[model samples]
Target: MAITSANQLELLQTAEAVAREKMIDPELVVEAMEESLARAAKSRYGSELDIRVSIDRKTGKATFTRVRTVVDEVENHFTELTVEEAKPFKEDAAVGDELIDEVPPVEMGRIAAQSAKQVILQKVREAERDRQFEEFQDRAGTIINGVVKREEYGNVIVDIGRGEGVLRRNEKIGRESYRPNDRIRCYIKDVRRETRGPQIFLSRTAPEFMAELFKMEVPEIYDGIIEIKAVARDPGSRAKIAVISYDSSIDPVGACVGMRGSRVQAVVNELQGEKIDIIPWNEDAPTFLVNALQPAEVTKVVLDEEAERIEVVVPDEQLSLAIGRRGQNVRLASQLTGLDIDILTEEEESARRQAEFAERTKIFMDTLDLDEFFAQLLVSEGFTSLEEVAYVEQDELLVIDGVDEATAQELQARARDYLDEQNKLALEKAKELGVEQSLIDFEGLTPQMLVALGEDGVKTLDDFATCADWELAGGWTTVNGERVKDDGVLESFDVSLEEAQNMVMTARLQLGWVTIEELEAKAAADAEAVAESIAEAEEAGA
Candidate 1:
C-alpha cells in the first residue's frame, strides 16, 4: 500500500471499524496510530530528533513534523535550533519559538505495520478493561445471573453479558456444583481493576444473596415498603433474615415468606435447599434476638448492654432447640441481632443467679466486716461491691428504709477503711514481688493492679509497655469446654478495658518506649505558652 492521501482514507476507515468492534472511542485508535507513526519516523530521522505525527480528522491526511525550539545557543542539536538557523523557517522566529519542519509521510514497512498493529491492540485492550470496570464497579453487592463459561481449578468463570466474573470455590454454596454452560445466579461481591483486566468477583453463599433474592420475589421489599435489617447464613444449611416494614399494614415476615412460602422457597432452591427463617426486626435488641431464635420460646432474657451480650433462659426441654445442633441456632441469632448470646435452661439460670448472690454476699461479709443480714440487705439492694458503697451518695444510701443516717455513715466509713486496708496490703505484696516504686506510682496504675502486675512478672515500665490491651483486660476463651471470658489483670484488679489501655499507654510514655517525639513536641508547645504568658505579664506591669 502506498503512503498516499487515498490510502490514508482507508486507514481512517480501518481505525473506525476497529474502534467500533472494540467498543472504544475512535479517537483513541487514531492517537495510538499517530504514536506508532511518530515512532517509525524517528527511526529514519535520527532517533535523537523530536519527531511527531498528526492525522487530520476531516481530510484523513497525515502530517509528519520535526519539532525544535529556537534558542540563543543549540545545547541539544536534536531538539533546539539557534535563532540564526530558525530564521529560515520563519523570518519572525525568535528565541523560544518552535521551528517545525513538515516532512513527507514515510512508507510503512512490514515491521512498522506490525508495530502499529500491536500498539493499536494494546490501546484497545486498555480501553476495554476501563470500560468494563466503570460499568460494573457500582453494581457490586447486587444480584447477577450468568452462564458458567468454564471452570478452572474449582473456580467457575461466568459470562456476565459484557464481561466475565469469577466465582471462587469458597464463594460457592456447599453441595452446589455447576458445569460448563450451566445457568447460575450470584451476588456481585466485588469488581477490581488489575494489570491484565477488570476482575469481577461473584459469590453464591453471601448473606446478601438471600436479601437480594427476597427483593426479587417480594414487590413490597423492592418498593421500600419492607426492608431487610440484617442477614446471616450458613450457606446450603440454614440462615436467618431480619426484616421490618415501614407500613403498619404490611407484615414484613409474611411478605418475605410469600404465599404458602413460595418467595422464601425460591431463595432456598437457589441456595441448594438452604433453610431460611424470616423474622420481624425490632428496635429493641432483646425483642429482635427473641424473634431470631425461632421455634424456641424464651422465658427470660438478661442483657449486658455494655458487653453487647445477652443471656436467654429457655424451658428445660427447649434448651437444645434454642441452642440448635452444634450451636448454629444461637450463632445465627447472635449474628442477626449483633450481640453475643448465651442460652440456658430455666434451672440453669436459677442456679447461676443463686451462685452469683452467694458470691457477692460473701465478698461484702469478708471485705466490709458486715454481718450476714446486713450483707444480704446490701446485695438485695443491688450494691455489688465495697467501691459502690464507698462512692455512693449518702442520699442514695439513705433511701434504704432500714438504714438510718448514722448507719449509712458507718457503712461508708467501713467501706473506705476496707479499700484502704486492701490497698495497703497490695502495696506491701507488690514490693515483695519485686515491683519497682516508679511502676507502682504510675498515674493510672491502681495499687491492686500493681500487685497483679508484680505477680505476673510485669515489674517495670518496659514489661507493662510490652502487653496488649487484651493481656491486661480479660479476653474470651474456652473455660471448662465452654467459651467464656478468661480472668486477666483487669478482672483481678476490677478495672475497665479503657482504664487498662490508658495504663499501658502511660507505661509506654514513661519508659520512652514510644511517643518520645510527641512528648517533646508537647513540651515545646507548653514552653512557648509559658513564654507568651510571661511577656503578657511584663507588658501589664509596664
Candidate 2:
C-alpha cells in the first residue's frame, strides 16, 4: 500500500468512519493513523531516525518528516547532530534547535501494513475504553435501565446502552432470575477502569437502589422537600428507610407511603417485594431507633454514646415481636441507627438492674468494712464506686438520710485509705512486671493504667508511644456486617481515645521524637484544610 494523492483522502475517510462507528473523537482516530503511519515509515527508513507524520484535518493530506536535534556534543548519531553538521539542513542552525527534512511516504509491504493495522485497532480500542470510563464514572451511585445480555457463571451481563455491566450473583435479589433480553433496572454501584475495559458494576440488592427507587416515585424526595436520611435492607425480604421532611407541613413517612400506598408499593415491587418500613427521622438517636423498630413498642432506650451501643427494653410479650424472626428486626434497626442494639424484655432489664445494684452494694460493703444495711444506704444515695465516695463533697454525703457529719467523715477517710492502699499495690505490681521509671513518671497515666500497660508488655515510655490510640482505648470494628469489640489496655480506667492520643503525643515530645514546630505546623495545616472545606461547602450552598 502506497500513500499517494489518491490514497491521502482515503486515510482521512477511513479515520472518520472508524471514529463515527466507535463513538469516539475523530481527532483521536486521525492521531492514531498518524502514529501507525510513522511506525511504518520508521521501518522503511533507519529505525534509529526520529520519523514523524502529520495529517491535515481539512485537506486530508499526510506529511512525513525526519527530525534531528542540533546539540553541542552529539551522542545519538541519527537523532542528534552538531551545529556545524546541521548547517546543510539550516544555514543558521544553533545548538538545541530541531532540524526537519521532508521525506517521502513509505510504500508499506504486507508485514508493515499488517503491523500498522494492529496498532490502529489497539489505539481505537483504548480510546473506546477511555470514552466508556468517562461516560459512566459520573453515573456511579445512580440507577440505569439495561437489557440482560447473558449470564456467565451466576453473574448477569447487561447491555447498559454504551457499555456492559456485571451484576454479581450476590448483588441480585434472592431467587430472582432473568432471561436474556429481559429488561431490568439496577443501581450503578461502581465504574472502574481495568486492563480489559471499563467495568460497570450493577446492583439490585444495594440499599441505595431502594432509596433511589423512592426518589423516582416520590416527588418530594426528588424536589428536596423530603430527604432519605438512611436505608438498611435485607434484600428481597425486609428493609427500613428513615426520612426527614424539610417542609413542616409535609409528613415524611406519609409522603413516602403516598395515597393508598401507591408510591412505596412501586419501590417494593421493583425490589422483588422487599417490604419497606418508612420511618420518620429524628435528630435524637434513641428516638430514631424507636421509629426504626416499627410495630414493636419500646418501653425504654438507653444509649452508650462512646461505645455506639443501645439497650432497648420492651414488654415481655413484645420481646419476640421486637426481635422478629432470627433477630432480623433488631438487626435492621441497628443498621439504620448505626448502633449495636441489645433488645431485652422488661423482666430481663429489671433482673439485670437488681443484679448490678447487689454487685455495687457488695463492693462497698467489702471495701469500706460497712454492714450490709449501711452499704445499701450508700448505694441508694447514688454512690456507685469507692472513688465517688472517696472524693465526693462532704455536703453530698451529709444529705443522705441518717448520715451525720461524723459518719460522712469516717466514710470518706476509709474510702481514701482503701484507694491509697490499692494504688500502692498497683504500682508495686507494675514495677514487678518490668515497668520502667520513665513510664511511671509519665503524666496522664494512673497506677492501675500503668499496671495494665505493663501486663500487656508495654513496659517503657517508648513502647507506650508506639501504641495506637485504639490500643489504649477500645474501639469497635465491623466484620461481616457485625460490630466486634476490641479490648483496650486501659479501657478499665476509662481512658478516652482523645486522651490516649494526647498522652502518646506528649510521650513522643518528651523523647524529642517530634518537635513543637512540627506539631504546630500540622495543626495549622489541618485548620487550613477544614477552613477550605467550609468555604467550598458554603460556595456550593450558594
* TM-score per candidate: 0.80, 0.92
| lDDT per model vs. reference | 0.87, 0.94
Q: Report the C-alpha lDDT of model 1 over 310-421, residue by residue, as the tens digit.
A: 9999999998899999999998998888788888899988998899999999998988887888898898899988899999999888888689999999999999998999
What is the C-alpha local distance difference test score of candidate 2?
Answer: 0.94
Each model's RMSD to truth, in Å?
8.7, 2.6
Q: Once superposed on the true structure, which residue ranges of model 2 sit more than 4 Å away at CA? A: 427-446, 458-467, 478-482, 505-522, 532-542
How displaced is residue 540 in candidate 1, in Å?
54
Backbone clash count, each prediction separately: 0, 0
List, residue by residue over 415-524, the lDDT tens digit for candidate 2.
99999999999999999999999999998888998899998999999999999999999888889977789999998888899998899899999999999999999999
| TM-score, model 1 to reference | 0.80
